[model samples]
Target: METNTQTDQVTNYVYIHVPFCLRKCSYCSFFSVNFSQEASSRFVKYLIKEINLFKQKYNIKPKTIYFGGGTPSLLTAAQINLIISQFDIAETEEITLECNPVNITNEFAKELTLTQINRISLGAQSFLDKELKVLGRLHKADEIRNAYKLLRAYRYNNISLDLIYGLPNQTKEDVEFSLDEIIKLEPEHISTYCLSLEKDVPLFSKIDQIPADEKVAEFYYLIRNKLISAEFEHYEISNFAKSGFESNHNLCYWNDKYYLGFGPSASGYLDFNSKTVCHPERSRRRDHLIRYNNSVNFEIYHKMLDEKKIMIDKIILNNDDHEKEYIFLGLRKAAGLNLEEFENKFKTDFTKKYDKVLHKFNNLLEINERTIKLKSEAYFISNEIFSEFM
Candidate 1:
């Protein structure tokens, strides 16, 4: 990490990545190794060391902590407590852990609640058994509901359900069935993602087997309308939340707040304290923003953590690119870009700066005195709109 100093403004957000999985889903691309008692124990020790080293290095007090993973639920309750005890967090901090159905147990859930894990984001990809099989999930469909009941039994009310649409051989009926099941469970948050077949994943070669582009578009629209009717706010492009339930941890990223990341294969963006070049919504003391990535290889990560000699891949952003990124990220939110905030931060006239691109997307984007956002009808093509900023 780049060395910097400030009397105030220490990094206030933290993410710890756990890269161990029992089985890597066929469509998944996250880094991971097989889970085992010995390996997991060592990983926990190294993570504790890594977190302490960075905490001392940066003097951070985390306001929100997310335990993201190949499968964070793989950790035993004792291990979770051991790692979380290292952090200096507030009493009201949002501590979230990820889980999959196969790994959840009623006893484990009870133990987890005792460790201060106030939130759970379950990877219940689909509520349909056939779809689960196609997605290579190890758990059966009924287990999703069972796991939800278990979490509720442990008083984890702030739960998020993760689902995927645009799947191979998926139908509109399937989409409705899944959403109906989700509404019945009544989680505080819903994150629906389109299936993208990236290179190297097992699903890439069989793209031809999936739903057509138009069909996927319909699925996206249906989900948006249904989720809205269910009283969930489409706060971000891929995320919906009940009122007052938006994810603070993820909002930090979209809002351009500085954060720290730990563990192998994890990434962080810190620094860049300065007034926005064109907009005045932000004023700060950051000099430059740098994004850094830790070593993805496990052995190298452990060695560095043990010796306190970690190396990172760094990219320092320049002013123009940074301004562009601010636009790019802000546009991904359902609340859209605040025009006055944009102009003030970048110190440019919004209407005049990119008139051509704005004109090109006039119909697809909604612009008003207070905001500029993608029209709900145009959200399925948000990627195309995002590329204009890129």
Candidate 2:
């Protein structure tokens, strides 16, 4: 909320969404369509147009670029290059592409390296075949192993393995068994997420079959301790990484920095203050914090962009909304919030602003004059603590 013009200028991260999949996962709620060469080609063209529109509007020079999916690996190397070529990316920008195991091959990896993509996030949900089937994953446990070896053989050192826990009938031992493989594999980063049976997803039909909340909390601690013991830093709620391997793109989000997201179902945020001041010496006439989303309907998106309609829903955040998001997102990081930074940004005394809530949850949150963080034991109940800020 206290994000001034200078903060906006420094937060130019980019996210490109490719929403096509061969099959849908039972737990997913993201907008995506079935793959077709003709449809994908058409979508790519529209995507380029959308990217250009943002580039023109914001004049952004990106610090990091994230290619997220419906399996970004499905696109040919040539297609990848075509999209990236349009961007004014830094030479050392962290270009990340999320991939599926079955889509990775040694030949494909070589071609992919040519695109200058430095980070590859392999979707290795679980090592147990039974659990994989429960989540409706396309590849088997063996394919995860094959994909890692293939990428390594091609010299892709900065790889991140994504894992899921708290599935139906999952246990602490099962989580430990999977971590054995993850630890042995020794990825530069590890992202472990708890399964959510979102409404309307196929898995929601059997929500009763999933583990209890208590069980899921146990699984959370199990994996947290595993990564810590293996010497991986728990940098975020669901992310662990070796030193210097934390995701720069994702860090932008938790730190409440401005980022531009392109493609259908993608969301973006921007903040600035107009220089038209009533008093010549004073800062800003007014601060504008805008968040926008493109149309999720693929057909509608294409028609709008092609005709220059650009069906984007834009919302201007009020002071309350911005301040709430600032605290909420900042608390998710492992190093936690700096008291001085928070106070300086918002032009407020941090402890004084949320005195009641901080006092109420004092046992769960560790607060000092300099910083504030959730205690390790209270991480599972973070939502409840964050709600007080709301």
Estimate, for each residue in 213-277, the C-alpha lDDT of model 2 and write its tens digit.
99999989989998899999998888999999999999999988888888888888876332321
C-alpha lDDT score of every prediction, in listed order: 0.83, 0.83
Clashing pairs in 2: none
lDDT of 1 by residue, 41-136 (tens): 988989888787665456678888899988899999999899888977764378889998888888888888779888899999898988888788
* C-alpha RMSD between model 2 and the true structure: 4.0
Cα deviation of 41 in candidate 2 (Å)? 1.3
Candidate 2 segments whose C-alpha is farther than 4 A from its true place: 1-11, 272-287, 309-311
| Angstrom error at residue 79, model 2 | 0.8
Structural similarity to truth (TM-score) of each candidate: 0.92, 0.93
